[model samples]
Target: MDILKSLGHPEELINLFKFKIGGCRTIMPKLDYESMSESLRTCYQYLNQTSRSFAAVIQALDGELRHAVCIFYLVLRALDTVEDDMSIPLDRKVPMLNDFHTYLYQDEWCFTESQEKDRKVLEDFPTISLEFRNLAREYRDVISDICHRMGVGMAEFLEKKVGSMKEWDQYCHYVAGLVGIGLSQLFSASQLEDPEVGQDTALANSMGLFLQKTNIIRDYLEDTQQGRAFWPKEAWSQFAGRLEDLAHPDKLELALSCLNLLVTDALRHVPDVIAYLSRLQNQSVFNFCAIPQVMAIATLSSCYNNPMVFQGVVKIRKGQAVTLMMEATNMRAVHTIISQYSQEILQKVSVSDPSREKTLHTLALIREKSTLSQSSLQSRTHHLSPMYLSAAMLLAALSWQYLNTTAVQTQGTGDMQG
Candidate 1:
């Protein structure tokens, strides 16, 4: 409902309005409280508190699928909490990570592994476990399997440092790729997405890697301050003496070199994401997947050649995110977004930059893989005036009330709906 209180800036306010108008249908779905069990009702409430944005997506999902996805997310969030908390020494932490899956069956089992920040989620583990235990066996299998694999991966990385880009990819696959794979399995069981498409390991891993790398790239300062380093030593060591050096004010230039290098490396996964998305058949599943990919590209574009990664958090604008959430419904729209951001990054990369060739080559691959011409991208992204878009959204709301479906394209004049 009223999500605007967080918007203090003009850009954020404007984007919030646009999102409310254009994304009302997808963003505001009817909650089936009548069907949710008591435990589920509590779990969904906790989900909203923990992640308001993700709650929007989960609630938008249909039927039992929504509840299943929420529990799966919380289960992983708990695991990640254990892994992220540096205060937990390696000895206790590794076993906690390895045995996390078993805790699902133990009612009221909770561990204070992470810091006080994640204390509530850990404390509430029993509630989440109860909900997970109640899910369909297929859903339970997917969640448990992914959690087990992710825990093992976390434990493995805890024992050693990330040495190379290969290790980096492996770590990301364990924590995030497994989540993508598990979601695909759940989607298949729910009959929301094609099981075959979900089975594409390379593409699914890339999907998770793309997003994870973006977060890693963005969180350099936070992760470093927390005394955790995820950017591969091989990659960052080439640019600076230490990973933390990238955030040093005196080493700003070298820091940016390291930042660009990582961003370029992350760009390698774009084609696989595009390929994976092209195979998706379900509308909600497509929208769910595409929105984040669009945001990732947009964030990468903002992060590229920007010195903010060293200083603090760098993010895509709220308006841009809202626009992507509303418009990124199909593969074509996603491609155009990726292409736009790819060009933004390409323009910033100079021939003299350390990773210039890799950056240029990776971005070019993204552009070529898009299969959309510049003219198509240009034509597709052109928007009617803001007033017109708002009007179309109004017409869309009216249409959804009657016809229950309206085809709202990203740009141009029309009565739009999702």
Candidate 2:
């Protein structure tokens, strides 16, 4: 029924149908939960409880790299929980952030005081830290170093507003870009990817910045309501006296102008994203990285010049997200998705908008880089009629039901034999 509702988007409908009928298993293989040690199992539990989006990809990672990345995410999530809890005084919060890395080594160091949503990771710190210590020496070093650096960076920003574009970049580097760098390093240490993947810090930083900027743009209202400001004063000051003013109904037009400008700034990192993804030779790693980058671009497309950004949350549709998860498995498909969404943003550009020229120039560069050849473009065009999509969806639904019934019957038969 959801697929039927998305019939207008035939590609998304088809992808949704495929995803519902076990295609996701092919893309994201399940891990052996019962086989893991108690601490690692608990860590995985904490991971899923903390972030569903990341848990799927992290589990899909190849071999020991999966465990490494899972522990890495839980560690950082615990650190972020500390930073997010506004009730913590500056002196205490700053020390926690700066010393977050050391806590990974302490057996009984858990912070049960945090009121943040994901504070369970902190409360169960021993489980997460024990798993962290079990990681290979190289993985531990990489995760610990990145955590320490990121903690200090978060501490520095706690006392400052994002005053300039450079500061915005710096803040994102501390919070997110460093995560990208650490992941790349872990990929290398796992020996599953090239050492150069970790060595390319600039491209890795861009990957993180692109996603971070998009999130900041999309979360304008939520951030403002929480008394948190991430949009650089250098950008928002041009259109409004205060960042919160942009949320006023009377300032909608100017708010959109400010949004467009930041979106353009975020788009500047696309070429680097392309370069970074192109260097990835591992399929699992590529899927893990590519899916999020494509989603960020799709999200940016949704938020571009859209007034819903300030009024409330703006997010990509579920069908669209499913399509991206399926299609972004390869570089050519990534290029197509990026090209398609960048073109969508191009169509929405306003001539009188404050960031018109900059937006056009950045998008043009992206199009030139991502544009497929004529033959490739021709092969990608799907002209499936709505009738066919509906029929396909129906068949997929029936197939799904049959598969579940067969699995149940097989289990019953095994029990009877036993």
Candidate 3:
């Protein structure tokens, strides 16, 4: 009831209604998750404090779907942390992860040793306290598979063995593309939509690519400091002249010019998110889709003016995040709002520079792609290459909003100067 009140009285402009757009149907066939030995109340408590939306979602879901999703998120978060930890030695860590995957599928293996073996940071996991250890264990296999694919890709990249930009895109697909697949499986299994859900897995993959690419771009400083470069050497050299010299103040202008194009490229997927949201036929799915898209928009807004986003943590204010959530309560408003904000961002860097005409030209292509994408939401031919996917998606999403809003002119608009 508290969640219902929060849902009904959401603080934003858009979240006023809830409905199923597609003809989705429920598919939860299992419910033995009730027998889990873990202190679920404690898990629920931790989740509420950390993620109110997730908590709301858990409360809203049926018993079977709730437990499965909770476990899935928990497992994925653990794997993601492992991937992000620069302090961990790859020699010992990668193998352990490989073994963790095997352990998940092989029930005879013990996870009790896992607690002792993992770094102190992961020692507090509730893996040992669950009856559905088997499920977590299976998901461990999922993590392992993802890692294996990413490991091979990263290895080739670092070794300079990747032959082309095509390969680079494939690498992003291995690590982040699979998240889309995993999410789609979860959506289908939850049966929270019309039986004939029109969800497009390709768009979901693009959405994930947009998120991951954003991280790579924003972490330019951090990744470089750690001796890990996710940006393709081909792009850095071809566009900006040198891969390692991106830190030089002289290159900043050209780099940022090139970077803006990448951001634009990433934005191309905004329509994909919109399309996906429009396809969802249930409340839980709608919330899941809406929250991430809102967060993505907010992240873009926070990163817009802050060049230091490359150097360190960049985040939206909690108050602003809550505002986005409140607004997201209305589906129509969410689309309109994101479109507007995204447009404002594109307008910031739309001007052409003579010195970096080549860079600007690249962005021009991105702008064109965005325009074309806006013209047809169903076309895959407009997809940007992988390394630039985040930048492209960001710019595209923003540009789409900008272009869409530009179609109408306000007559006799009186300006109120504050």
Candidate 4:
């Protein structure tokens, strides 16, 4: 079924196929880390193994911040491993979450019960911890503080269901919003960006909230199948007998209504995201932040009022992601992308839809706030002809796979680098 869907919809295959082969090859540093300490080398190896998208961005960063950010990401990934492992007993998990930051200092702490995808990060955490300890005191303090706060937050919600809009925001803040705050602190500490640039905690929180909400909305099917639910009862309960009821084939309309409402609620964060992006000073930092924001808005656009949220994954095309990544180098580019996707969502919201009024109002705010001039909007719209777009995409996917393979060969690839 998935393969057929991929064939009929080549945009879906393009990213997966490319990511598997050569998604971020151009930005990656050369393979030889001979100058790095053994611990740093192992940590970088582990980071490359664990997260391709993040590894790509971290490597793109300038100087010491790159290493600091890499270690920071690994430490959090280790803490998140402990938090995300549902199979562990509550007694074990809760304490682990509460003390995860301290574990980064211990250098011997390791958790073996993480899900398979993340298990290596848990087992090899000592390498990450070693690197974490070597970081400058300012960087170490910020990473440790964020990990401590996030761990406690995850522990608080482990046994409770998210029941309201407020709870949803709190949960997201714990897991993701804090990440935004921590990164701001790191960027400021690195001296690469102005300290004042990271001070807007509310906007940083909104940036993280926007991404987290979009993921929750996109992963409805996967989360439900796995017995996890992050969408608050406040919205879903109004549309269905139960949250999982929307997943049943029989409740397609109600499911889409609920999905659209969630998307609409998530849109309230857009302006704040724009405000946050506008403060960034570093080009790499801007790219790192802007790509994800652009991707989130693009995903929301595709998922808005679309029934696929209940069916399977709904994603932006690889072509679209590459375009955004290449062109979204400034606030103006970011605004244009947001304007485009917001328009896409507004066009799709129907008058009869339950959330149409809320959706329209939210999108109008986005359109009004975007700084995209009419001339820029006219020059930016790029789409291939549908008839041969997929065929061309298939060839592009194959080319990326070949590029990824040959790039690894030339660069001395790390284990599980993809």
lDDT of each: 0.79, 0.88, 0.51, 0.81
Steric clash pairs (candidate 4): none
The prediction achieving the highest lDDT against the true structure is 2
The RMSD of every model to the true structure, in order and in angstroms, is 7.0, 4.8, 13.5, 4.1
Best by TM-score: 2
Residues 1-418 of candidate 2 have per-residue lDDT tens digits of: 3444455676765676576566777778868988989888898888877777777778889999999999999999999999999989998999999999999999999998888889899889999999999999999999999999999999999999999999999999999999999999999999889999999999999999998999899999999999999999999999899999999999999999999999999999999999999999999999999989999999999999999999988877767888888889999999888888988999999989978999999988987777577577567777678687778767755664565578687763111000
Runs in model 3 lying further than 4 Å from the true structure: 1-62, 85-94, 97-99, 106-168, 194-199, 239-244, 302-306, 353-418
Residue 241 lDDT in model 4?
Answer: 76
Task: Tell me how candidate 2 scores on lDDT.
Answer: 0.88
Ranking by TM-score: 2, 4, 1, 3
Model 4 bad stretches (over 4 Å): 1-32, 381-418
Q: Write the residue-wise lDDT of candidate 4 on 338-386 in tens digits.
A: 9988888888888788999888888888887787888988776446687
lDDT of 3: 0.51
lDDT of candidate 1 over 1-418, digit per residue (tens): 1223323333334445555455457654668777777878888877877776677677777667888899998998888888888788889999999999999989989874457565667888888999999989999988998899999999999989999989999999998888888888888889877778657777888889999999998888899998888999998888778888877788877777778888999999998999888988877778778887888888888888788888878876655566677778888778888888888898899666888998888988987788987787888643568786666555544543333223334342222111
Worst 10 residues of 3 by lDDT: 15-24
